[model samples]
Target: MAKTGEADADAFVEWFRAAAPYIHAFRGKTFVLAFGGDSLLRPDFVDLVYDINLLNALGVRLVLVHGVRPQVEERISEEAQYVRGRRVTDAATLEHVKDAVGSVRVDLESLLSVGLPNTPMAGAEIRVASGNYVTAQPAGVVDGVDLLFTGEVRKVAVAAIRDRLAAGEIVLLSPIGYSPTGEVFNLTLEEVATHAAMALEADKLVFILDHGDTVDAQGRRVSRLTASQAQRLLKELPEGDMKLYLPFAAQACKKGVGKAHLVSADVDGALLMELFTHAGVGTMVTRMSVENIRPAGIDDVGGILSVIEPLETEGVLVRRSRERLEQEIDNFFVDELDGRIVGCVALYSFAEVRAGEMACLAVDPTFRRGGRGDGLLAAVEEAAREQGLKHIFVLTTRTAHWFIERGFVLGGPDDLPAPRKAMYNWQRRSKVLVKDLEAA
Candidate 1:
């Protein structure tokens, strides 16, 4: 029992230490968490609240936008009519919508206010703020049906929300919007969250759904996608909550939001796991390709140094001075992620032999598992081919097998071109591997 307790304590400390970077990264940043009323009905709602309190404690500016669709359905006896996913809100249904929205708003506010001793909320002082932050215009006469009070988000009060956030208050928004003409409009949870994140340029726009992470056609959980890829996947996905919310996530990414996430309310601590960990428990959508390979410029010398310096110290990569790197920057291709260069490879062509030497291939240790090395290598190969080179080769002391696995063949120094062979480091005795570009 003592050993088990010690092991558990060590694990907890390690986990907390691992999350420190993310904590520092997210502090003072804004996140918009959106969910349906179905989330409040779940047994895990208390757990979600606890996590939200933790985020608040960590200094994350939060905007909580909730939908009352399920709550409104429970209040109305008649069947609901929908045209193109917007509820056909008549006079009677509009009243029910208002009641449900008000009830949900109060319930959320009360839950966020909890501070009982010995509980997760103990000593946690959370102030909840809610107001007319969303402006809406009614979706009038869609498909010949008067969608009376069903509305679309016209604008979000960015200044008002920022004021609350600056005051250290958690801003709450209901799916109920008020117009300038003194009329109320019912909005969708997706639209409100999307617009608010866009308007605030929030760091993350997260949707807590009833299901787990988004899956592919083979039922495999997908971890990351670009906006274009998500749009392509949307056509194949069946009609469900994931399908319904995916477009909103993609739209937010394309508009201006840093990243959009679709996480499961069913999974405990899904929000924390998704935001703090490298391998999140949800699917993330970005604006475009997350890993971009582009020709290296003079400005990329420092980033390239950051990636290759550790390997140079370890003797896996040859040492190059900053001046040398700057001069050869034009021959390098870098893999950039979120504006940071994570990987790089350089192609030096030998016109005498119509061949290129791929060198200085290194990826940041943190990003080594994402196939970025392969991407960087592909960029070099393509560049070599474009320059009319017939073959490409690499000299690696530690990563011979990695290159061999990627179609490179082991060779002796005699196989190298005259210029490269003369410059080969005999002291390192690195293994030379060559690949035929035409065959590839």
Candidate 2:
């Protein structure tokens, strides 16, 4: 590295240029990002605010759910009763959950008050409301244990949240809900998001949590899974033990909530990283096969869109403009069924080195099990080969197993070609899978 005199202003330009297309695709989509108390109240909270400001400026609709379990517990006396080995909620505990969740919302709004291009997020903007959207019922009994005032989601006012988001409001949903019969209950952030996703029919239902432990048959953590797979995995979890957060995610996905993301609370910029770049940070659970894969044609913009609209609602794939995809048309491929476009994949390439990246690989659900993904993959690989490239790679978080089965193996960040690296955004940490087609 030369003297720090030469800043990579040029690199930033190239960086945004490379990312804007995909990022713009998500501009108006509803994305629910659940931030944990740990991440929110971290010492370096200013950095997090900056991230939020950036998200706002980019025009992404934001809905935030914050956790305050520690604060709630600390205030609860050492004498508070425990029922069935869980915190027994008394009058004091419920109030504290309200306070903790309230303080978090106030503090977050306060943080935003201090920064950003347009602080419409505050008073001059529409007032932010927290309660009532989540009409809840008591999480009455757990494992024969009497739980007091622990609210479980009964219904979500999807229309209300949707109206606000459509009006360009950043929705802040603190983990506090109103119950029927005029009572309030403390709800888990996961429960809130699950019901919200299902209600909003959100494009993406994501959880930024302290722990996750979903794995495939192999040793690797399967980062992407379908709702069915997630449900199957959930059923395997012992009753009253919902550790992975996949069951609710699967519930949301099955309910047409779109894609569900479970990621580390500690992974700063995980949201941005997942949305903006190819390499993403966490496990994404969706309801479809060939996630983000699809079939397209020059004249079938409507057809391409017809396939994407349903998935878009569930948030499995971010939405993009027909014109934009057309501009990048040469990068796309199709799955032909007697000349009908039943499946498609898009290949984004680094032409300087003749290397290419595969994206948007999808086939009709009925056409699945007919070797569509494999066939399309072969076609793309052949195209890459025809371009005189020696290797082609896929960056995926969940489907690494599928790629591994097809001769691709895990690769580190440095293993990526330099040009591609220039386009990598640190937020996503999208995992890489590579296969070599060159001969010795």
Candidate 3:
């Protein structure tokens, strides 16, 4: 059942706190932030600045993309020119965009400097950089005008952004780019963030926009959403103005960015609130599937041991007799298909306060390519996550590549807990894979 009132708030807090350490693992990971001009214009600007600083402190690599739609239209109107909603990017207007984007970049930098003064953020040391990384698709003409140089993004060079990110620098993209053929193309803020996340394989794509967040049918905050849920919401609200961002958020996740957070810039410390509490601040859209991972009952032990015995015989897995497995049945989770178990994995969920071990994974041969392995692995991760475990370990003789493909990174035996390492036997020697799941 859906939670209510304090219960709902508590859920947000729990999810946040659970994610906190997992978020810590995100340090040094690249994140693409798309800030709408309306959001930047919010009265709660101080809250936004504080959140940015907090992310910096957490060791996250930041990419700030700010919108300038209203600012540009306002700039043109103030000069007594006809107020065309579109950006008039002729020679003179293009120069204005250069100036405008520059101004926004400088302003953001100055705001961040308030928290970290005397840090080399002025002049060339922290100057903005723009290049031909973005290719364009001409937007159709509006209001009888050709709409000139304003265009949408058709492609991007994500590697270039990753280079900047890996070098321990914050990249601030200004949604303004020069085409290969000497023409300039203006892009939407969300499009800029979406393309960058895809190109960079960022850990998350955050869209901080103006106005309050979405509400549920019951009027409570629609606090959490998976990728599919968000897509459903988008479909249900086709006529809703807020739906403009739905497509961008989905595209970001589809490109493998881990999450897309749609939150209110009005809420004070919303980032920390969403991240530090259990139920988060706004909707988090993710590509993660809805597979359930948990402890296996006694009945599952025989099947699991049967699967493990083959690998054990080949030395890919250590020997675990059916009797011994029955005693440890609580350590396993099975992947189910129409109520029949198709795959299973073991979780040692108590090596650290928020740590677990994934071991003895096996899938029915028929379900091999049906994503049962991935499902079992994800289920193990989810079980650990629900237990508030911050990290999980896997020791595999084969399938190291498979784990890596699923976001596992290489580690040494020493990365395991002391007891686990001490209990390790030469017969079980295998490459270790570790996944760090912290909150952001």
Candidate 4:
């Protein structure tokens, strides 16, 4: 039994170590967590709170937006009608909305304030701050039906929220906004969450969905999508909780939120798994293609160095100084993943020979096996073709097989363009390989 316990401990240590990069990436980043009131009724809600406390401990600034839909229904004893996505909050329903939102606010504050021994909050001193952070305007009539007390977020007090967050407080936003004239109006949590993320320029907007996972038409689970892809997929998804959150996620992305995540509140530690793991437990939506292959900018020098330095040390790549990289920065193309340069290749065009030399091809060690290297090569080849080059060549000592497998053929030094031949390093004795760009 003791040996088994030791083995389990070792596995856990390894898993924790693997999550270190995510931890570093999220530290000091602001995340807006949104959920419906129904989620609070689940048996696992306490566990979700514990996970939230864990995030807070890790230095993540949090703004929690919760919808009181179920609670409002319970207060009114009927389902509220929504026309064109705006709830028709009549005068009678507005009273229920106030009661429901107030009750939820108190409950969430009480839960987050817990500090009992032997609990997740035992030593946690989490400060929950709630206020009139969201300014509102009446949603108005849609096709002749007045929304009455229903409202939409017109503005968010970003400065005040930032102040609270700077002081290590979690800002809690109930789906209740106040007009400039001091009238309270019922708000939709989705709209509030989306606008808040935009106003705050948050790193992420997370929706705790009832549905656990997202799948495509073929029933295959999808783990990531760009905003454009999400918009296109939304048209095909069935009417469910996931579908309901898709538009809001896309809107958040459009307004510059770094990413939006849809994770099930039903799953224990789902938020942790989605944020800290490489293959997230839920679907991630981003504003643009997270993996971008484009021309490297002058600012990419540091990232380029980080990707190739190890390869240089291993003698797999030739050493290039920072000054040299700066001079040739325009010739380099990089594969940027989530804003990090993970792979790069430089295309040195030989206009006289109608040929290009692919050099300094490198991918970060951690990301090498994931086809980022292939993406960089494809990008460089396309760029060469655009520049009217008919052939592209590479001189590699260690990655010859990689180039060869990608359709490059063996060639001698004499096959190189005259200018390139003069600069060939005989000491390295690297093998030359070339590919015809116009070939099928």
lDDT of 4 by residue, 1-440 (tens): 99999999999997798689779978889999999998889888988888889899899999999989888888786677879867799889999989998899999999888788989768999999999999999988888999988988889999999999999999999898999898989888988999999999999999998754566666666677777778889888877668889889988987899889998776779899999975677888877542488899999999999998988999999999999999999999988888898889999999888999999999888876654676677678778989999999999998887886567989989999998999999999999999987772
How many residue pairs clash in model 1? Answer: 0
| Cα deviation of 313, candidate 3, in Å | 17
Against the true structure, what is each candidate's TM-score? 0.73, 0.62, 0.58, 0.70
Candidate 2 per-residue C-alpha lDDT over 1-440 given as tens digits, one digit per residue, 9 for 90 to 100: 55343457666786687578767777887777775676665775566666665676667777777777766766776666656544566677888887887787888877765644544333333334455788877767787877887767888887888888877777888776886688887777777877777777788887765543334434345555666667666655543222447677777877887678876555667666666654366667766543333335477666656655665565544457888877877787776555456777777777776667776666667677655676678668767887887778776655676776567779976767797788765666667888886630
TM-score of 1: 0.73
Q: In model 4, which range of ten residues has the least summed lDDT?
A: 211-220
Q: What lDDT does each candidate get?
A: 0.88, 0.68, 0.70, 0.87
List the candidate 3 regions with Cα displacement exceeding 4 Å: 1-20, 78-96, 115-133, 140-147, 238-241, 289-440
Best-first order by lDDT: 1, 4, 3, 2
Which 10 consecutive positions of candidate 3 have the poorest summed lDDT?
119-128
Clashing pairs in 1: none
Candidate 4: what lDDT?
0.87
What's the alpha carbon RMSD for model 4? 9.8
Q: Which pairs clash inside model 4?
A: none
Best candidate (score: lDDT): 1
Candidate 3 lDDT over 348-433, as tens digits, reads 87645567989889887766764457657766776788888899889888889788656688998888888788876666578888
Across residues 1-440, which tens digit of lDDT does each residue of candidate 1 receive? 99999999999998898789889989999999999889999987988998999999999999999989889999999999999877898889989999999899999998998898977769989999899999999989988998999998999999999999999999999998899999999899899999999999998999998854577766777677777778889888866678889999999988989899999887889899999876688888877553398899999999999999999999999999999999999999988988899898999999689889999999899987655776677678778989999989889999997887567899989989987889888999999999998876
